[model samples]
Target: MEKLFKQVAIVVDQDDALVKNLENLVSLTREWQSSFHLIYVVERPAFSFKNIWKGYANGRTQPFDTAEHRLKEYQEKLKKLLPEGTRIHCYCKEGKPLWLIRNYIHENQIDLLLLLQSGSRFKRQPIRFSQLVGKINCPMIMVPLHKKDYDFKNIVLPISHELPLKKIMIASFLAGKKNDARIHLLALQEQDAKRQRTENPYLFKTYQLIRDNTTLTVECHPVDGDNLAAPTLEYARKVNADLILVKPGSETSPPGIFHRLLSKFNFSSSGIPVMTI
Candidate 1:
């Protein structure tokens, strides 16, 4: 059978903590046996004659070369963690990260992208994982820097009428692979009374789809909240869920300082790996 994620790409960074988490990710996805590609982009600064001359004069290693070295190190570490004979390739480039990564995904037909969420902050400086949310063609998994180990035993799938049911299948596929895994369908309660009544059919249909399609144990519960992310994450925490299956279009609070502070409470900061599928 064809694998769910046949071609997987991981965005490599210099964060030591995230690099440590690679072992956990590799171990978790061993079933898929997918080809893993590691990509590291060196953010290039504006050209300056003095900088170039200094590098040439001092024989300092170029930024691209440095990126290649780091990525090779990552490749070696992953090689040790991954099963023998698994395909691994490394790409080191100097350019705008967002552009390069998107292009790479398209050009290489990456089925899934794994990115590292740096140290306790949802919005990291210089590189924000959220920026690539809807931009990439394929789904991406955001693994928290502090997340050392995990199992797909308890997978959280927050369902709402507004969101697509595609994630249901993805959740089921993952949960079905592991021993004794369960999928929690957290229905987002609509604040408006009229909309709440109208949305029940969609919720029930989602529940039925999971029941008919997969044998994994399933649970459904109503979650109350206007901001979709907060309640979903809160429930995951309450249940001690192992993984959360989120979407690229998952709701977020308005852009402001208050929202920034609240974002810290989201799944990325909780050291839980969230798959934005």
Candidate 2:
């Protein structure tokens, strides 16, 4: 049988959250028994005197050596966690963070991309999920820094009348791989009563498709709420789900006071690990 994620790539940056990210990755590698590529990009400073002055005045050392040092440290850390004979490659490069990371993933034919979903304090611009989700070639996992000891046992998959084939397929594939794992399908309801009537038939159709195709256990529950994140999360907590399969439309809520009140319910800030293709 072929591996689900043959060539996994993880984005490394300067943040305290990186430790949690690495821990989660280690957990995944342990379960899958797969190798991964660790990439750290030293972003170039803007061509401004103020930027130059800040670097000099702050006595900030050159980024190449620093990046290498961090990479080595992380390499040692990962080795301690991963099983013996597991291959690990580390790359340190200088370029724009977004462009370089995306190009590298494409050039290397990465199967999965792991990104930490928190902002960095020192960097001018961190790698934002909204910017790279559409640009990347492979599926991306936005790992929440707070969520540690990640497992693929219970996966939350949000469903709509339109039916996301990719998300459903991926959920099924993952559930099939894990022992005693189950997929929870959260059927999203529309506000309009006319549209809501059509949703149930599609939900049943989706339920039937998964039940017929695979032997894995699956459940479909109707979720009611204006915001997708709230009800989905409520269900996840009830089921003790660890992973969420989300599309860009329902997951990527715009940043504002409303979003802030919900603790910024976007790709990275969902307080749960979210995957988008």
Candidate 3:
């Protein structure tokens, strides 16, 4: 069978910690038999002498020779971190970091993009990142610097009353592959059981579909509150989940406090990664 994330790409920089953490993510992705591609974009200073020497130097505009040499050095350093027999490629591009990454995702049909969320140093502006999150068509997995090991024993997929059934099925199919992994289908509801039964028909349909689609064990439950992230985190801690998969809302109404809180919580503060579909 084909791997889940066949073409995975990771963005790296000079930060040793970010590089090391991203290496761990690549290791985990490889464990799932996914083809990996690592790209290190060197952000060069715009005012460098190479840019100044522009048209006068044989139509050369930048210090590409030096950049290429530096890129090779980074490739060698990264190569030492990977397991043997894993095929990896490196690319060195010059531009704004996030913009470059967004373009690369479009040009190459990258299945999943892994990014290291550096603390204050590389703090992504909420508005800007939110815009990219909306525009990017594929799934993006954000891995904080601390979360390295991917122990897939427990995973939680937060579903509201309005989620599509096909999305849930896709998540179930992934969870079923890992031995002993439990898939928790959480429904955060403000109404009682009888009210949910009358109001949310899709929820029932999703429950039935999960049961019929895969042999993987799944637990369906509801939380009696409007705060989706709170209950989702509680369930994750109780189950000791290695990852939490969530679906972002539409562009007009992007993921709110519930979604952002998951990434901001103490559980995700460490090594646990969150996958947003």
TM-score of each: 0.84, 0.80, 0.72
lDDT of 1: 0.72
Runs of candidate 3 exceeding 4 Å displacement? 42-74, 77-85, 119-132, 162-166, 190-200, 250-271
Strongest candidate by TM-score: 1
Q: Tell me which of candidates 1 and 2 scores higher on TM-score.
A: 1
What is the Cα-based lDDT of residue 85 in candidate 3?
A: 63
Q: Give the candidates in order of lDDT, highest first.
A: 1, 2, 3
Model 2, residue 41: C-alpha shift (Å):
1.1
lDDT of 2 at 118: 60
Clashing pairs in 1: none
Q: Give the true-structure RMSD of model 3.
A: 6.4
How many pairs of residues collide in each model? 0, 0, 1
Could you tell me the TM-score of candidate 3?
0.72
* Candidate 3, lDDT over the whole model: 0.60
As for TM-score, the candidate ahead, 1 or 3, is: 1
Ten-residue stretch with the least lDDT total in model 3: 121-130
- Candidate achieving higher lDDT, 2 or 3: 2
Candidate 2 C-alpha lDDT tens digits along 103-202 = 8888888888887766443443346666676688888887766666565778988775566677777777666556587888877565555554334456
What lDDT does each candidate get? 0.72, 0.71, 0.60
